[model samples]
Target: MAFAANTALISSPTLFTPSKFSSSRLYLSVPYKTTKFQLYCKPSSSLPLTSLFCLRKKEKSVLSALSDDFPAVLDEIEGNSGWDVAVEGEEGEGGFVVQPPEEAKVYVGNLPFDVDNGRLGQLFGQAGVVELAEVIYDRITGRSRGFGFVTMATVEEAEKAVELFSRYDMDGRFLTVNIAAPRGSQPERAPREPGHRIYVGNLAWSVDTGRLEELFSEHGAIVSVRVVSDRETGRSRGFGFVEMSTESEMNDAISSLDGEILDGRPIKVNAALERQTRGRF
Candidate 1:
């Protein structure tokens, strides 16, 4: 019976069977008609060979299609089965084998702030075909977060990128490249606080409440803008607060303004935390 190349080898007896035996291990030949590849196995001591190595009937194959040639089988599966990494840690130690995250996604860090997705893709394409590239941006400022992700066409290609591009210099800055963590492994961020107020910091000395309002107004409706000034000097204290007309407007302002460059300096913006007041004893 012809099996899809992407199909799991365990699916059919003709593809993988106990063909050769050594003292301790068994060599299973994965044959697609005329082409043969050996898959090494240590047979289970307690189960029958068929029971231990066979695949279920209903499950779909992992490869793309059954082919008459070996290289085509690699091509078929390379495009179809995404990385399904399985990682297990040892007791008291982190000894494990992890497949590249989600098949071919790679993390790129220490990037220049000006590098966009297109530039990043072109840079990574040197290792292999890049399927997609994206740079994370602050929601308000639309400025890059100095990191991004790239998905390669295949797992081998992703590995090649890590091998060649990790520590690669781009305009004097070295980049950090690695297999991206699976989505489930990422930490959950705390929800933004309620209230239409946001904190803005790292203001240019020349920036006044008016300029602040004008800059943020492009993002949303602003209720008020307050630049905190020094109590003694009357000069700008270099920080301020902005109140948007609504929570949505506040969020928009945060997303657009944080990481925004002003006077060659990136500003910090975030949801306003409630100010703590001293309690009378």
Candidate 2:
């Protein structure tokens, strides 16, 4: 007696041949008509294999979409399990090297004052190749600004860094790690008004009042965009206040901009509190 096999591939599909395994179970994703189902099968001579046929479809694997590294990346991650371990090192040495402009960059905050370029590179290098690591500092005081940027070799590496370090407590502070916004892309600032207002926090340093107003203007009429800056340096405080033309506009701005990424930072948008009227009382 003889048996026949029929297979149809519609899109990207993975098929396991019975000849590959003599006595083991193989799992496959089989698509039929418009439905998809999982198939667990073991081929044996006694059983009719006609029902084990499959119609294949061409589609990119989810894993492939994530990164071309695929299974190899898994091994890399496992091998670097000791990345977070701290080692004794010198301080304030191995100054930062500027990386060529790249999209795969991450922001790191809440760093210890003593952390230098070398220390930061060691910590983030665990995830992937460290193209550059720089600690922001005040030009006048020559002191660390308590935050910095890390540029990875690839987007995959940058994502891995964020997953490994975001909100991870190091030393005595919890770190805030996120994608870095492109340089020079600032937020717009609006003028303070008598109407409704909101508070926006975690803004990127590059963002200015004009950009902030432009972003919030989509929700409603923005009365003003005031990004609080330091009196001495005039740098952004990483937070700002916004006022809208009306209460409805304010609410709309809150709903739209909250949790949205602006200049690679996830901003916090909420209603502003009223100033206490102590003198009147």
Clashes of each: 19, 27
RMSD per model, one decimal: 17.3, 22.7
> TM-score for every candidate vs. truth?
0.34, 0.34
- Quote the lDDT for 133 in model 2: 93
lDDT (tens digit, per residue) of candidate 1 on 82-195: 312122332333434233338699999867667999999999999998888999986654667668999998899999999999878775346778888777787554454555
Tell me the tens digit of each residue's lDDT in model 2 across 27-146.
Answer: 344432221222222233222333232333334332111223333433432343211111111233222323445569899986766688889999999999998899998687676766
lDDT of 2 at 204: 98
**Model 2 CA deviation exceeding 4 Å by range:** 1-101, 186-230, 233-281
For residue 13, model 2's alpha carbon misses the true position, in angstroms, by 54
